[model samples]
Target: MAIDITVDHAVATLTDGTQLRTPFWRIDSDRDGHHLAMLAAQHGNEVQGIEVARRFADLCAEQLVAGTVTLVPYANLLAIRHRRHSSDLGPEQPGRESQGFNMQQAWPGDPDGNDIERVVYALDAKVIAHSDRLVDMHCWNHFWAAAVLARSDNGVAVQMAEATDLPFVMWRNSPAPEADIATSSHLMYSRGGVSMAIELSGQYQMREAEVDRGLRAMANVAKVLDMIPGEPEIIDGPMLEPLAGNDVVVEAPCSGIFMQSGLEPGQRVVQGLKLGHIVRDDDLETVVVRSPACGRLWKYGRHDMKCDVRLPDQHPYASEGDMLALIVQACGPERE
Candidate 1:
C-alpha cells in the first residue's frame, strides 16, 4: 500500500510582521536515508531553480514513495508576486527597478528586517531545521551561460557534482576582489549542510536542454545520496577555481562599440590572447582587447550592445565589458 503523507503549510510571521509561508510535504517510508530539501527562486531573475523544484514536487506526487523530500519551490513570493526583485523595491527604484533585494544574500535573515530579510530568515528556519541535504538552484547572468558552484574541495558536494555531469564546477567562492559573496553558493555550505548551487542556464525562457539537464541532475543527486537506488552516469569536465582575489575586470578604457571574436562560453584562452576589439566608431578604428591571464573563458558579453562594458543589473546585449567572458585556471577531476 502507498504510504500516506502529511503536508504542512502556513505563514511564518517574521519579527517585522512580514509573513512568509513554509509549504512542505513529509512522506513516511520504509527506506532508510537522510532528509533532502530543494529550494529555488530566491532571486526573481534566476527562475530555473524554481522550475526544477516544481517538477520534482510533481514527480514525487507520482513516484516518490521513499523517504522525505521537502521543497520550497518559490521562497521569495513577494518578489515573485510583484514581479519586482524585492518586496520593498518598486519598478522605479532608479536603475535597479522595482525588483526587491536579492533574497539569497539575506541569509540568516533578521527577525526585524527588510521585507526580503524577514522572508529569508523565516524560510531558512523551516528548511534548515529539517533537511540533511540541500540543493539551491540558480541561473547565470543573462549575458553568461550556465555553471555549477560548490564549496572548495567538499566531498558531499562532490558526489552531487559527479552526478550532474555538468561542463564546469566553480570551486571556492569568487576570489575576485570585486566578487560578491551575498548571492554565493557558500551560504548553504556555511550552514554545515551538503549543498551545491546550480546554474540551470538563461533567465527568461524555458530551454528544453536546460530543463532536461536540471531534471537529470536532480535524479542523479537522488542516486548519489542513495535516496534512490541506482548508478548514475559520471560527468567528465574541467574543475575550475573561481577567479582569484587579484583577478582583473577588463573595463571599457574608452566608450565604443563592441565586436566579438566568436569566443563561446567555456572556451580557452592564454595570457595576452586577443579576446575581441572595440571600435570608437562604426569606422575601422578597431582597438584590440586582450586577455590578461592564461585560463579558459568563463563569462562574456551577450549579442546585443556595442559597448563591452555594461552597467550592473543591465539588460544583456553585446557590450564591451559586460564580462565579455570569464576565464578560469582550468584544473583536473576532483578527488572522490
Candidate 2:
C-alpha cells in the first residue's frame, strides 16, 4: 500500500491477471499542509481527466515539495478500454448495478458491494480519506463542452473552483447528495475535505485547446493548494459567479438525429433560441430543438452539425432524457 513517489507505477493486479494503473504519491515531512488527490476516467467516457492526472503525477513526482498528491489516471479501466461511460455497460460485469450513474457517485463504497463499488471503497478509504482536497476531472455529455463544479460545501467549492481557472465554476449544492448519490467530489466533501470537478472538452471528443485548459486548471489547483511553487494560473474564459444547482440542461425531446441550426458553443443564447433540429433516423421527420435559457454552449451536440463525423466507439448516442448540451446559465434558477 506504500506509494513510492520514486517510480513504481502499478497499484494493483486484478483477479483476471491484469494489473491496475500505476499511480505515484508523495508524502511531505512538513505535515502542516493538505493531502491532494487527482482522479480521472471514473466514468469511462470522460478521458480528458486522465491526461490531467498523468501530467500532474509526473509534475508532482518531480516538483511537489509539501503535502501529498496521488494521481489515479485510470480509475475504471474496463470502461476505459471498452470506451464506454459506465462500468455497468462493460462486457465483464454486465449485470453489476451499484455504479448508479458511473463510478463518480458511488462513494464510501461497500467492501461487499459490487465490483465497481469495491473499487470506489478502496479509492475513498485508501486514497481520498487521507486527503484534504481532490479534483475529479470529467467531460461533456456529447460534443458540447463543459463547466467545473464544486459539491459538498459550496463555500469551499468556490475557493477550489477559483483555483482551477476554467469556464464558469458553479456549486452543485452545499449538502452532499444522500450517500447513495454522493459522487467522488462530494464524497471528499462529506469527509471534511474540499473537492472540485473540472469539466472540459467532451465525453468522446476533445480539442487540444480544451485539454490545455484542463491541464492549466489542475496546475492552478496545485498552486492554490501550494502543492506547486507558483500562483494559481488564471482562466481567461468567461466565468460565472459561482452558484448552486446543476447547469441548465436541454434534454432530448425525442429519439432522433440532432441537427444544429441555431446557437453554437461559446455563443450567448436567449431563451427560445433555435437550438437545432431532431431528424428521426427512421423516417427523416424533423423536430425543432430550442434553448431553455440564456447562456453559451459549453458545446453543441455533435448530432447538431457534425453527426456524420462522430465515431460510435468514441461517442455515446444520446436518447430522450439525455442532456444534449449545457448552458452556462446567465441568470437565476427560476429564470432558467
Best by lDDT: 2
Model 2, position 260, has a per-residue lDDT of 73
lDDT of 2 by residue, 203-306 (tens): 66556666777778877777777767888767464566423343687787877666777554555677898888777756777777788887666656744443
Candidate 1 lDDT over residue span 1-336, tens digit each = 444555666355765565567666555455667677777666555667666776666655555545677777677787667654455554434214434366776676666766666666667676655667877877664455456776656788777876776656766543454544454244455556677778766654566666667777777787788766677755535445455543345554444666667775545667787877777544547687787776556666534331212343443333444455566654332221
Lowest lDDT 10-residue stretch of candidate 2: 90-99
lDDT of 1: 0.61
Assess every candidate by TM-score: 0.67, 0.68
* Poorly placed runs, candidate 2 (over 4 Å): 1-31, 90-101, 176-181, 241-264, 267-295, 301-336
User: What is the TM-score (0 to 1) of candidate 1?
Assistant: 0.67
Query: All models: lDDT?
Result: 0.61, 0.65
lDDT of 2 at 256: 67
